[model samples]
Target: MSETNDSLAEEKELLKSVENAPASKKISTYAKLSGPGWLQGAITLGGGSLGGSLYLGIIGGTELLWLQPLMMIFGILMLSVIGYVTLSTGKKPFQAINEHINPVLGWGWLIAAMLANLVWAMPQFSL
Candidate 1:
């Protein structure tokens, strides 16, 4: 019993140390740590994923389990490309695009993305 309790305590301390160690290293190197949180929230809150989950729960049950895996694959592919572009240039995605390509093209893409998001927002609010 004492051995079990000691092992659990050691595991808890190891977990905390692992978590805090990365954060301390980032701070020491002046690296930004908040980007991952925003990236995670963006992926998790995407309309397609949420809609699929809701629709599956309402209509199809677990029969549509395959879609979730497909969505995750595509989402990771996109994020990987975005992260590569951002990291290679040390610029946010928007700035990198506008800097490498024409500002007009960059802004055009931004406007199109905004319009798509606006279309998505309408159904979200109605629901």
Candidate 2:
């Protein structure tokens, strides 16, 4: 336990040193940029997905049978757009949009995403 605590304290000190280091001393660009893509995929695969499925099942009573395919199509379209943005500008979609697109469009996407997240939050919050 003492050794573990000492190791953690050492790590904390290392992190503090890194934080205080000059920008020129820092290594820029690592594997972590892939994190958002994995995180987005995980959200799609996990709670958002299960909840969307259950909500459709309960609310639409099988009439939403077509919605699964529709959602897939929509997802593909959105991802394609993201791909285009990335390929064209060598930047992530959010950054590409904010940098290249109209300011209004950038803000609009932010608002739309927030609203979508809010809607998704409703069922989880209620339960």
Candidate 3:
């Protein structure tokens, strides 16, 4: 009975300490919350990227290695902007883009993304 009481007290104290922990000190909290977005970004590097790299290598050879890095930098910048907008406003990207920017532009982006995915997936499926 005494051992059980002691364990319960220790558990309560641990819970209290966790509840009082500072936000900045909780790196795992941010990591857990942001993990899905990171996973999605990683998974997006699929057939399209492979195809692009193959074409770039064949056509431009080593000379165009700089272009791939440049494109990746731009892609990172774009994802950062989308993440900021989504997180800050607590809104989905397409809705936020349509509301704050232009609806036509938003729709255009969606259509273009869909087309690109289809184009990329087709070659992979054919293989």
Candidate 4:
């Protein structure tokens, strides 16, 4: 939509202007533009994160403190790889999924994805 495009353009301009600003100004600008940061935080540190942390704490005590940081590093690396692939390939990933990595495997992947979505949506029913 034009509205979304306009806002994105405006945000890009604001980011460009603040690129070399003072640290405080840059931080404030970033904070202002990061409208979805809270949503991302919620997703990242939601119920699953709490449960995992509690389970790890009980099992490994302080010995597993490094695990989180290590996992975060790997996650970042994987995200970066995915981003690079997206940038390099104009093709969409789901297209391949729909086409079938051969029909049988494609159906398997599609079924798994559907089941994952079903499980993911289960918590929302409690609301």
Which candidate leads in lDDT?
3
lDDT of 4: 0.67
* Candidate 3 structure quality by residue, lDDT tens digits, 1-127: 5996796697667556666578764555546545488767655676667887899799999999898789779878877877787766668999988888789977987897789677654565543
Better candidate number, 1 or 2, judged by TM-score:
2
Kindly list the per-residue Cα lDDT of model 1 for residues 1-127, writing each as its tens digit.
Answer: 5996796697667555556567776464333424366665664566665775787767877787787688669857766765687777878788987887578866876896688567544455544
Off by over 4 Å in 1: 1-32, 36-52, 57-61, 92-123
Q: State the lDDT of candidate 2 residue by residue for 36-109, as single tens digits.
A: 87766756565666777888899998998899889779978877876898678877677888898766776787
For residue 35, model 2's alpha carbon misses the true position, in angstroms, by: 6.6
Q: Where is model 4 poorest over a 10-residue stretch in terms of lDDT?
A: 92-101
The candidate scoring highest on TM-score is 3
> Which lDDT value does model 2 have at 116?
70
Clashing pairs in 4: none
Q: Model 3, 76: alpha-carbon shift in Å? A: 1.5
- TM for candidate 1 is 0.44
Name the lDDT value of residue 104 in candidate 2: 76
| 49: Cα error in model 1, Å | 5.1
Tell me the spans in candidate 3 whose CA falls farther than 4 Å from its real position: 1-31, 121-127
